[model samples]
Target: MTRNLLSILPVLALCLWLCTAASSRLVKRSDDLDPLEAVVSQLSQTVAGLQAEIAALKSSKADNAVLLALQTQVRSLQTITAEHKVAFLARVDVDVAANAPIPFHAVDFNVGNAYDPLSGIFTAPHSGVYLLSTQIFPQFAGDVLVDLYKNGGIIIRMRVFDSTSPTSESTSITDHANAGDKYWVQVNVGGHIYAGAHSFFSVTIVFPDS
Candidate 1:
């Protein structure tokens, strides 16, 4: 029994540490953190159940069974975290032209290769509901109007009027897209971006098609 307890002690300690680390990151409300939060919830429940089972092993000779269960649970958690993640955040640092798509050349991340930096377009890799957002910032004192296009149709529009200082406007839309469908941001009224990280775009799958 002493040897078995020693063997399982390290596994229990590692699981407890992971739970604490994951719990600390739950304060932020971000779309990208959704998957991590789900996994954390599952791990927390698993840890609780394992603790209960370990307590019951004090009077039973089920040490091998308990150790096997812990190993299986740990493997399950590893697999969950290793799944493919699809998301991207891109920003435009150069000036844009009117009636043209804003080329977000600076790609911070492109997990699924759905976003093309050369043409400033996002093609869906999977059929699902997506949450898309964009921000427009004017470099000079002028009016800036931007449109979010889904498959060549306007879905969301943002307008910013900067008379004295640089200002930005942002908006988001939750819509459905099929695989290979395109989404992009275009300049409707003005095309002059602030030329920095202030003007940006991001998209992520919220609910995949089942």
Candidate 2:
């Protein structure tokens, strides 16, 4: 009877040890699963943060592109504005008989009566410094006086005497003339100033820096 009791006690102890080992394995599995779940949650949060940063970068890139386009447009507009400015040159000629007064009245060009007919009057075509010159051909020995007037005032007066054939005199007038500024010239006195058909005086207006 004693031997049988010992054998039953050994079998009971072995069954209790197997049950304790199974319980420890289940607890360790549960602890490992908790840590894995926490890792997966942190990885999901990090992915979301990266996605937000990518979106912000895309927005900044778009803003920079828009600014660059605007700058290019501004430069183009400035170039066009510079090209739109108007600049031009004009030439005019007036012929007169020697000793016979040749009148370039301001009223003829619709400028106004700002000049006297007896004193040569020439209307400015545009605002600029004009180089005025006169060429005269006389049949006999004579003298020629060329006068320039501006704003109803005498600006310069030039004279040529003892001229038998074609004679020329030139003078520069620095004047800020509008589109309708008045100017003129006249021959004061000359001997036998008018004889041949070719014997006459001519005036020319030129722009020095056209």
RMSD of each candidate?
23.2, 23.1
Task: Tell me how many clashing residue pairs each candidate has.
Answer: 0, 6
Please give the lDDT score for candidate 2.
0.49
TM-score of every prediction relative to native: 0.60, 0.35
The TM-score obtained by model 1 is 0.60
* Range of the 10 consecutive residues with the lowest summed lDDT in candidate 2: 84-93
Clashes of 2: 6
User: Model 2 — TM-score against the truth?
Assistant: 0.35
Q: Which stretches of candidate 1 lie above 4 Å from their native place?
A: 1-84
lDDT of 1 by residue, 38-60 (tens): 87667667667666666777546
